[model samples]
Target: MSFPAFDAHHPPDKDLIDDCVHCGFCLPTCPTYVLFGEEMDSPRGRIYLMNKGLTEEPMNDQTVRHYDLCLGCMACVTACPSGVQYDKLIEATRGQVERRYERAPEDKAFREMIFQLFPYKKRLRLAAGPLRLYQRFGIGDKLRKSGVMSRIPARMRAMEALMPELQKEQKVPELTEPVGERRRRVGVLTGCVQQVFFSQVNSATVRVLAAEGCEVVAPKDQGCCGALSTHAGREEESLNFARKTIDTFEGLNLDNVVVNAAGCGSTMKEYGHLLRDDPEYAARAKAFSEKVRDVSEFIQEIGAVAERSPFAVTAAYHDACHLAHAQGIRKQPRQTLKQIPGMSVKEIREAEICCGSAGIYNMVEPEPAAELGERKANNILKTGAEMIVTSNPGCMLQIQASLKKMGHDGLPMAHPMEVLDASIRGESVETLLRR
Candidate 1:
């Protein structure tokens, strides 16, 4: 009853596997390797397993465990000196794993629940109603103090811990005119989790773009960018979302498609490769991808036209892994933040390492994700910054939870767009610190 390691459908590419020189450059930057020091958790080690799957062995529990442990942070892709495409390799490998392997019933059901809930905005909004009441009534704290939390599944506990305080939903208009002459026309991706839970971030993004003389169009019809599904290797589901996204903004004739969230931007930028097999969308996906830009990246490119008011504060800036490693967007965010009149941006140690919120990794793999989150939180504390600034909602939630555990709960966290928006609108520094 032995089976081939991979089926006839798209497996990990043999040529890409051979591109790894095994030079060990990616070892130090890998979060799992840094945490466990296991060779099996490193990128080189995973590539080795991938090679074995292709030639020597069948896909088994051990092999799949190693692959599942990957955060898909793409730090290895940034660290590799040989230019090995670990991003493509791991993506292909995960897709194969999802298709070829069967999971335990509970594991499959849990993953199914995540995929079902996370990728839809309306479902998430509906779920948020209950979460708001839980936070307001302090049920989460009561459950933990009563020791009832210990009885819950680890993944469920992790999910509960990572919930951010829900606020009133801020809706973006279908079209917003520039403050002055329109320099560029851009369409924005109001993401799923971002739209439901972190709507303020989207509102800030639109305001900042408008203030900078850009005609901003946020199509209400747009849905998930498929970042979670794509990262988790639900290939067909991801492709479907990608095609819908492409279709949403296709006829708008915009200068750029702006994405504030790092995870969504990374996956949206890869629609071409993800849909390369689709005869109808192969070319359209590539064209749509070409116009995709991270909000800070877009701001940096267009140059700042709005006046920046002074809001003096020392801030720790976290480089979201997808923005930095997956898209090579290291400098743009820093440069954008520095544009503010009196802002001081401090860098975190091990900036290249992940903060353990790679899509849903923190929820599914709770222990490792917690370890990495605490490690990142400690690094942030050393800077003594008054606030934390990052571009991704997931990173914000992960870091906030870890900092809360460390009793630094008073420290505020904000998206870079919010900071910029506050400054541009002459809001007081207290406005940001109070958040």
Candidate 2:
């Protein structure tokens, strides 16, 4: 258990850590704390450990483990009445961990693999080929039935199981002209994983925006927005990605940058905070951050002008943690869903709790992620909704895998944008599914 010397540059803010009154308001909302019933795992407890690590205590395995267990859902931030900035505290702490801690060799390799593969669009595309072939040839099923999957690493097995049914990737053009009078001109973010895996969600988002009389500008070469890197504490890498993303869209002179994925949107909207230290990009990043908007948020602001038809199905809307907690967007997504006639948005218990898809969390920490996923799945199933609707691709995959694991694979799952696109086009559910 070798530990690198603590780096002072990214130490947790003592002022923020001191803000926690330890009121226990966050205990019930923290998924790890609730699951483990360990004081060291709770928000207040982590803040205490952060104080120790920052002041005099040496960084050790126990300290690192507590932080590793956190999902970074920001539910505790939402739950705290004392205005403790747990999000910033956790992020800064993780940055220190990345810079000043030497993880076990295998853990380091796994993280490096994830960072290298996930943040690069082309790498993920090329990597998906073998996975798609495996799924296409029914080898995945054969391996599972033969129990060979059990011999593989837990993280690898989890990733294999959560592999989405591959679809022909849809490419968004440089510019999509609005149908009627263009009320707003917006740039759309085609996320890295979302573009490769759930490309239809981005396509649907563009279609819906165009249908609502918004000109869509989706740059073909724009790269990942650095949500995964930032969430995982690769601060320097995240800043590089943020600078590139700002450079990609800043020249378009668009009214807004629409993001359908919750995590990307949340991080994009914080570009100012991420780059505030950069002398050259500070102002530009602030301006760029201001223009970023979630699709649901943008639609609500502009009002849904497209006449929607009915899709009479009971669906539960799962709040992607970033959307609901980080971005404080709760009503807009539900409001967007309600526009379709006969669409009943049933409320699931613990809607604010994460589905254990905090970026690549389920892949990195399978045990706790699976527990939270199953907890989320059971609550959603109890709602008796025929489908699960969410805005984030990660959450959709997370919930879908959980449901399948629970033997409730019959439930359909989709992004809200997808459903809205279907209604706006008057397409049947069968047609939507086929796509």
Candidate 3:
């Protein structure tokens, strides 16, 4: 008895697969390809595997391993000259893999635990309670000092290392009035990990938007934008989250739906295609996607109106892969940062390479993720900047962990919104650095 490689639901599209011209342009930008120099790990190589799976090849451990190694950072989309839609191809391929391939018991359970925990805010917060205690009491440091970390599994250790210092949660109001005159009305997506762990980024985003003459609305009912699930190829889960998110902000009359996190914005902007099969949400999703904008992109579109006080710091700007490559938003962030008086934005080498924080890639594939993170950290150090500015929380944690490993842990990392908020609020450079 023979079986087909992919089930009947939605196999990777042959038309899309044929679009890959086997061009080597994606090699340098691919994180796994750059790290291992493996053809199967590069976008072109993976597209070949996907094509084989579509024909005679069956889905097996080897094929699945190659797919699993992909970070889904979409850097290839930016690098490709033929404009291949590798994002859609890989996403469809992963969905097929998740449905058809049987994994080892441990691997299956680990993936299940991640999906269960990371997408839900409440579960994450509950887990954070103990983690906060661990960080607060310095148990994490003590464990590191005692040299017991070596005994732990690499995945668990990666999770521990990526844990950012939890600060007191800063809540955003459901509605915030514009400072001077209302120029536009916008609804914000307060993301899952972003809200629980990096709430300050959301708060600062609201503040900056309001100060810039935008009446900001943060619907408390909004949940995960499904970037994690979407990237991981949990098709139904991601689409469900997408439908719920669309429903939450649908009735609110707004000029734009703003997002701060790079990953979230990229996923939210693709809701139309993600839900195109659904008759109910296909049209609604398209409308919603058009309004979705990265906060920096939105601000740049509207033009910054608020006065910027001097923030005297030379900061290296790390372009989060989702923002720069996935969304084609390379310049808006730097342009926004340059608006700050006395602020200099230095660019990192290999600006297109991912920092090993492609959603939960670091947590799942710890070794490769660490290699890329260290590589990114080395480039960042070469910039000689006082602080690091990026738009994604995952990048913040991954880069911080890598820098710590290199004994440069004191280097400050911040979101662009936080830096912009400090400049607008007239906060001292010292105060901003401490944050």
Extract clashing residue pairs from model 2: none
How does model 1 fare in lDDT? 0.94
Cα lDDT tens digits for candidate 2, 1-435: 222325757578778988999899999989998899999999999998988886668888889999999999999989999999898999988998898789999999999999999889899999888988888899978988999988999999888878898988999888999999999999999999999999989889999999999999999889999999999999999999999999999999899999999999999998998898899999999999999999999999988789998888788989999999899999999999998998999998988778898998999999899999999999999998878899898898888899889998878889999999999999986676544
| Cα displacement (Å) at residue 162, model 1 | 0.3
Q: What ranges in model 2 sit over 4 Å off?
A: 1-5, 433-435
TM-score of 1: 0.99
Please give the CA lDDT of all the candidate structures.
0.94, 0.90, 0.93
The parts of candidate 1 lying over 4 Å away from their true place are 1-3
Q: Which of 2 and 3 is the better model by lDDT?
A: 3
Rate residue 176 of model 3 by lDDT: 98
- Per-residue CA lDDT of candidate 1, range 271-343, in tens? 9999999999999999999999999999999999999999898899999999999999989999988989899
**How should the candidates be ordered by lDDT, best one leading?**
1, 3, 2
Better of 2 and 3 by TM-score: 3
Clashing pairs in 3: none
On residues 285-400, what C-alpha lDDT tens digit does candidate 3 reach at each position?
Answer: 99999999999999999999999998889999999999998899989999999989899999999999999999889999999999999999999999999999999999999999
- Score residue 59 of candidate 3 by CA lDDT: 92
Clash counts for all predictions: 0, 0, 0
Worst 10 residues of 3 by lDDT: 1-10
